[model samples]
Target: MGLTAGVLAIDAGNSKTDVAVVAPDGTVLATARGEGFRPPAVGLDTAMAALAATVARALAAAGAPAVAHVSACLANADLPVEEQQLTEALETRGTTVEVRNDTFAVLRAGVTEPRGVAVVCGAGINCVGMHPDGRTARFPALGRISGDWGGGWALAEEALWYAARAQDGRGAPTALARALPAHFGLPDMPALIEALHLRRVPSSRRHELTPVLFATAADGDPVARAIVDRQADEVVTMATVALTRLGLLDERTPVLLGGSVLAAGHPRLVDRVRALLADRAPRAVPRIVTAAPVLGAALLGLDRLAAPPESHHRLRAHFGT
Candidate 1:
């Protein structure tokens, strides 16, 4: 076995898993991608086995027998109990392991400093904030159960709901009445509903309609536009709350937006978010983070390792926007 000690970084979201081995000098040695993380549904043994497979592949590719640290940012780690369970589950793979909510990866990726707020709207939406003094603000982010409003899945479902209503005259007529059913190659809302109810259309694929919603909005559909606008409002609401909790609302705090939906840079969505922040938290600067979140996990590990600023800069340069 080769003797290269470095940080093992893992960013495990609901849809994908990214793992990387990075040297202390900021060199990324090896990287691997695998199926999304499975936990809370799948038992601990199954989850760890899947994760271990990816880690073994990365270490093998890097020719390293062991890493000094393991930093994993994972989805569904909402409650403190969940975090503790994940930490215990992941520690079996490395000498030192740390697990945090995946939104923390977004926060670390966008802000150069350790302090900032991040709202990640991917398959789901979550918000997190950190202060330099080590205090943090976060949400449960368990969908409607946790009072969360926006995410790709939720947005897509909302689009479908409105479109179905419009077709039946229960809601205002909109382009969605035609466009949404057509997206799935169906003739109309009734047909689409039948397909969904019969399980012919996979419910998991509903998130595909998120981009469709945006495209329809771009085409000047007021209903679709309203949905996009609501998403922006939700993003601001989460960010504003985080900043306020951390006492950074009036300060020059950096608000980072990450995840596929936000990072896609939808003009209507991004512009509205910017506009809302102007009134809600005027001093907050917004940034869309394009860097892969695994980099953030790696950076956090480097911080724990006490690597200097130069190392951080090097890693950033290697993964530059």
Candidate 2:
């Protein structure tokens, strides 16, 4: 686990994979991108094969015979047991490897030190926090089963529910009734609902309604606005809990907002999130993170290597952070 041969960093997501070879001096010698790494879908052997191809390409480009350590930030490594399983799988390559949930990548990418909370909300939602002492906080993030809510997919579903109810006289009126179907070129909520129910609209395209929901909220629709506000509240609630768990609530700490939903910076959601955090965790400095997660993986590898500040600086500069 020494840094004799330098570090290999991997950022593996559901749709894409990025890998890098970094010298001891923090010089990025080579990098590679490949297909998605989804062990659950393709099985461990298939996923590892895809990852190995990308790693081999990176190592070849770097002219490296081997790496001493592998730092992997992987999607689906939700629990500690999952990280351990991945670590054992990667160790077969004859390198010491450490696996962490991909949320850690977003968290580390946003902070100079591994001492911040990061909440990511793309198709799904997740949160992770790390204390400077190496303690970490995370959740199962298993959708509703894990008591999570307010991701893009969930928001879309919620919007449809309200719109349907309003159209059927079972709930309060909202512009979402018009906006949701309009997004799909439908005449009304009933038609939209029928299309979706019959698969004429395809379940895969449901995420397209999220922005329509946001737009409806921006137009002062009470139901849509409530949903948007609830999302913001959920984000802050998770951040507050993480900060409290790490004993960072009273201290000034970074709160990183990432993934598509937060990164979009919708005024209603983003502004409400800021306002709530200011009230609940006044010391937290909240901001959006745009750095590539792979950079965080590389920086983590360098951390394990105990590389100098110059190394960290060079790595960040190279990644244009």
Per-candidate Cα lDDT values, in order, are: 0.90, 0.89
Off by over 4 Å in 2: 1-5
* Residue 91 Cα positional deviation in candidate 2, in Å, after optimal superposition: 1.3
> Judged by TM-score, which candidate is best?
1
Q: What is the C-alpha RMSD of each candidate to the true structure, in Å?
A: 1.3, 2.4
Per-prediction TM-score to the true structure, in the order listed:
0.96, 0.94
Local accuracy of candidate 1 as per-residue lDDT tens digits, 140-159: 99989889998899999999
Which residue pairs clash within candidate 2? none
Q: lDDT (0-100) at residue 237 of candidate 1?
A: 98
Model 2 agreement with the true structure over 62-144: per-residue lDDT tens digits: 88868878999998888888889899988855367899988888888889888999999877889999998999989998789
